[model samples]
Target: MHGGGAVLELAELAFRELALFAAFGFLLGALDNLAIDLLWLRRMIRRLAGRRDAAPWAIADLPAPDRPGRHAVFIPAWDEAAVIRAMLENTVWRFAGQDYRLFVGCYPNDPATRAEIEAVARRAANVRMVVCPDPGPTTKADCLNTLWRALEREEADSGTRFKSVILHDAEDVVHPEEIALFDRLIERHDLVQIPVVPLPHPRSRWVAGHYCDEFAEAHGKDLVIRDSLHAGVPSAGVGCALARDALGALAAERGGLPFDADSLTEDYELGLSLAERGRSGTFVRCRGGDSQGLIAVQAHFPATLAEAVRQKTRWVAGIALYGWERLGWHGGVADFWMRVRDRSTILAALVLLAAYLAMLIGFVLLIAALATDYTLPPMTPVLALLLGINFGLLLWRLAVRAMFTGFVYGRREAMRAVPRAIVSNIIAMIAARRAMTHYVFARRDRPPAWDKTRHIFPETAVPRP
Candidate 1:
């Protein structure tokens, strides 16, 4: 090839790389704009209005006329024996005084978990344990599926009726008053999402900070936007309530399909499917600190950076491969927009990977040109502005998170955690890329079995008499 042609080809490649980097930057920037303009503003305004202590919109007062109906607290357990007992204990203790029933979903192979759950049931008449017959690779979704089957058979025999179904994680320790909130919301909304706030350890590790950041951004700002726009708010895999009628209809429409079956991130997919199936799912911002909040659920934020990354990686991979195609976003503008947002989130790490490569190449080329006495491309003000704008936006996000998070880890501690979070990002990026690649290349496009996350339960603070 001619020297001139080779140089032209090289220049074309560089331009393409730059364009790809810019495109990713633009997508992230647009997402930032949406969060700030649509969601964060409401959160900030709510703060300014001093409405933090105000009562939740879901329930004005407890013991409303519609509080009493057959409601099932569906807790899907898979190898959760470590925390399952505590979770069930709290569920029973809290609901002991309520007018509803407690149903725990467990796998038969997990004898310890089954036994503990059974003991909890024996202690409380309102509690019952159902075995999930699936011997296939264990997933929370499968457990829920088995529970749904059991419920169906029970309803068939006795003609029992239920008004609502609430999902809770085994690690969760819900507030006593949460039942009332759920009862109130069930009376009005088809689906309702309650805030899942992280209960951070005082001496939390790096992963805890990352979890806190997610909760602050998602629960604090993200839900605010969903409320403002009247769009759907996805559940945090827990504290989600579904009206029994709508749930029954969804199940019937799907030929009595499991509530969340064969999906990695079933909760998220469930929420999206509900929205697509013409159901309204909304959020309620409850009042107070984590301890004083209306619904204080004890959930362990990944104790280590590696665990956090694994969780996010599975989420990104699951959502990208299974959710987007199945959600059917092409049907309408709203669906399309939701898909767009979900895609942008899933692609964030990929975009960053591309941008980093481009920047590296540009840097190496600039250095070689300087050393070789060759003319280099001039830096433009627009490029500088673009870089500054991107950095500023990220900094703004961190700042917003810090402001609302209230007395977070010290600056030194945060800096230590940042690298751990970065490591997590790298792992998640690799996993997401692999999942996406498999989705496009594999002959069978079926989703792999869900790998349950290992929970490191926080040591309970001993109560002083």
Candidate 2:
């Protein structure tokens, strides 16, 4: 009886400490969300008053380009034989008649992916495949660097230069007008990013469905809000366009390599680097085509929990770990705060684990108290107030998330977003731990390998714009 009581007392003590940490972390996150919420509200109010912005428009008109400027689409493929053929064909059909060339980067060893790109290139006039000298998947950035060199060589040989460089993955569903949109906007903005809508798998709605929720809110509101604050717009690794000259400047700065070859999230780093260098970058989310669908780069995300965790682990390692070591905190106030927010994922996962443990311990303690008839102390007023505010903020965040998710994916997925939020939290926690284990203290004997997820192209025929 005495030992049981001691165990219960220790559990109670642990529960208190864990709850305090979780509550404090939640409050801090809530405060951060509140700031962004207030900023978004302010933006909407001004827009309601008929305010006009030069760069980031809420609804911009995009018409077909009249003999559009030269544009190059860069796709870095590694073991993407499954979907590369379909994606390439779709890109050719969608962007037909547009003055753009598709430059695909392939590895010498990955003949499967190279064959797919070659099969498409042989049919399309504008499609070109650049083979990397390296054997296998060195890094996505290394492939991109090879493609950049190829583009420069082609320009030198042909005496023609591309005006903008658009980045896309092999699994992307390219919008017909996105390249033209980039061509038009690249004159003013160094980088322009369109919405990235992750296609939810029919089978894994609860797992892949959460991505739709996240991208909906992020691309729909958070990025727009960032532009309103004149903050740095980090690239989503797809559906982003960079000006040719801006990229050239970066290449020159980095000894002819525009991308950081060692970085996991090279596209993301490029956007932030351009922003830090005072280059203009904007995000646009608007309707395109007669169907009135959003001009987003839709792609299939991971459907299984293991795949999701692996992909997110790469992201966690890239952004919160390598990103910090590479790009130290130096930017405007808004940009600085945004960087902190991005890096907070590590701490956020820690808090989530603490909160879950606290809940478990609390349950155990509650049952012990019930069995023993032992008295418990009253809740502290400070802790009570903190939790109360966090609850309100939680409800607000869920409502807002649902609103954004429904905006893009409709009511059914929006309702599912509530449960998927739990899944997302678990994935984040797992990814954080995995990132620390696999990437942070990784062995440095050999080069970092490209760890890309298997991609899927939509089997259904894509509708023409």
lDDT of 1 by residue, 1-465 (tens): 112345634854774567457655754655655555555565556756868643343345333745567677788777777887767776676665776667788776788888878877877787778887765356777777777776677668869777788888877877676667777777777787877767665565555666765665567666656555556566667888888888888888877864656566788887777776778887777643345544535577676656666676677756766677666464365455556666665567666676666767676666656666445555556666666766666566555555545434346544544454455456556767766765677554454565667765554621122
**Model number with the top TM-score:** 2
**lDDT assessment of candidate 1:** 0.66
Task: Give the root-mean-square deviation of each candidate in angstroms.
Answer: 4.4, 2.4
Q: Candidate 2: which stretches are off by over 4 Å?
A: 1-4, 54-67, 444-446, 462-465
CA lDDT scores, all candidates in order: 0.66, 0.86
Error of 2 at 5 (Å): 1.7
Candidate 1, superposed: residue stretches over 4 Å from native:
1-31, 34-39, 42-67, 136-138, 153-160, 201-204, 258-260, 288-291, 294-296, 330-335, 358-377, 407-424, 441-447, 461-465
Best by lDDT: 2
